[model samples]
Target: MLSLVDSGSGTVVGRAEGEDIVLDVHTSGSGPALVLLHGAEGREANDAFIAALAERFTVIAPSHPGFGLSPRPDWCDSVEDLAYLYLEWLERQDWHDTMLVGLQFGGWVAAEMAVRDCSRLGRLTLVDPVGIKVGGREDRDISDVFAISRSELDARHYADPAAGPGDLSQASRDDVLHIARNEEALALYGWEPYLHNPRLQRWLHRIHVPTLVTWGAQDGVVSPDYGRAYADAIPGARFELVGEAGHRAQIEQPDTLAKLIAEHSA
Candidate 1:
């Protein structure tokens, strides 16, 4: 049985496990079920987005193993593993008419899941997702996020770099640790194939659920063109561009992104 405890912060923390793996899940609100998959920056980075989503739907957000306070099992390493794990978790929850939304890395995970089994999902939204290769072997569709300087990364990640996380020197200890953990986990999973699954593009057509792919209009990490390709790969998926935002559209424009998601899922 899954064990949930009150986190005293309006969110309930639950442990969802499959075999030896356990995921730290944060849940809140009440309405139709909406499972949110967070980006490489981890769960805390999407706090505002989650709160906005919670207002309309019961938000079930899980910290991928190795992110936040979740422990990563030795055998679990890739996004594919996370996809299967979350799929099992969804089955265990037995939620119907669920909306699955993925942001950045989490978007990749959600796509992987839907391509495998979308039986319980009613809708899917991928925001600035990175999981498929749409460019030639010599072309780079996604930017090298790690290689870039913090200033450069911020500029690429947020439409208004001034609005990005400023002056890390003032960050709390917990915040620093969370950031470090996120970076480590992201590199571990995305380093080899450079964030795109070699086979995911071939299987995207397997996803038949009503899908929406949203991208930051000014996204430099992965251009809007890449987002278009992502939408085109899935059957009947629509694409939209969130203006005045970069790669992290949910962070840059939570209300706008939330509205788009709410309308689509509704």
Candidate 2:
């Protein structure tokens, strides 16, 4: 496992390698390893969720390449590339059969990793994963979050916009830059297929490990129907809906989400 020093807030921040790519990772708690993959916005924003999870298990949250302060490798242009990179990182850390959690775009990464190879992963939790064309092009499976304004995007992601991240207009310069980098990275990875892998559904059968799939009841970005479709694709996966929440359950319902994860992992 990667050795980490506390960041003075019950979390440890550090960098680790994934082949040629360097990832900024935060770790806390002390128990079985629990690797967390953040969404397009990066790890900094999920401090509450991370801390809550850290209370029960070791939480290893990593910022995707090109997001936050992490440098993106030239070759890392797709989610598939990210999956392999994470696999390499896991092997280097010698972590096996550990709990794995993914949120939003991170959930897409977790699904890809779980299906590709589950030897290193234990229980798997996917929170509103968006990475497949569930319906025909005429039917909107996922919202065009990239095409919308910041306020609109927030509105779609949270039942109460005030509970979500601060508006970009009111953000600090550093926060704005970080968001720009995150959006650029999201475009590089998910723009073409529009947040999905064409063949992922067909390979869901490969994920035999225990899985929990959760979604926000009021998710406008990707409806609960889409979340149900994802759970149905996986064998023996359980599906749940958190009421009064939208796409970002971790933000709106951290305590409840963390409790679910803790119980499921147990």
My TM-score estimates for the predictions, one after another, are 0.92, 0.92
Best by lDDT: 1
Model 1's C-alpha root-mean-square deviation from the true structure amounts to 3.9
Residue pairs in candidate 1 whose N, alpha carbon or C atoms collide under 3 angstroms: none
Off by over 4 Å in 1: 1-20
* C-alpha lDDT values of all predictions: 0.86, 0.84
Per-residue lDDT of model 2, residues 157-260, tens digit only:
99888876666777777777777778888899999889999999999889988999999998989999999999999999999999888898888888889989
What would the per-residue lDDT of candidate 1 be over residues 1-266, giving only the tens digit for each residue?
11222243222222344344555778898888999999887888888989999899999888887777777777779898888888877777777778999999999999999999999899999999999999999999999988988789889999999767766788777777787788888998899799989899999999999999999999989999999999999999999999999999999899999899999987
Give the C-alpha miss distance for residue 205 in model 1, angstroms. 0.7
Give lDDT for model 2. Answer: 0.84
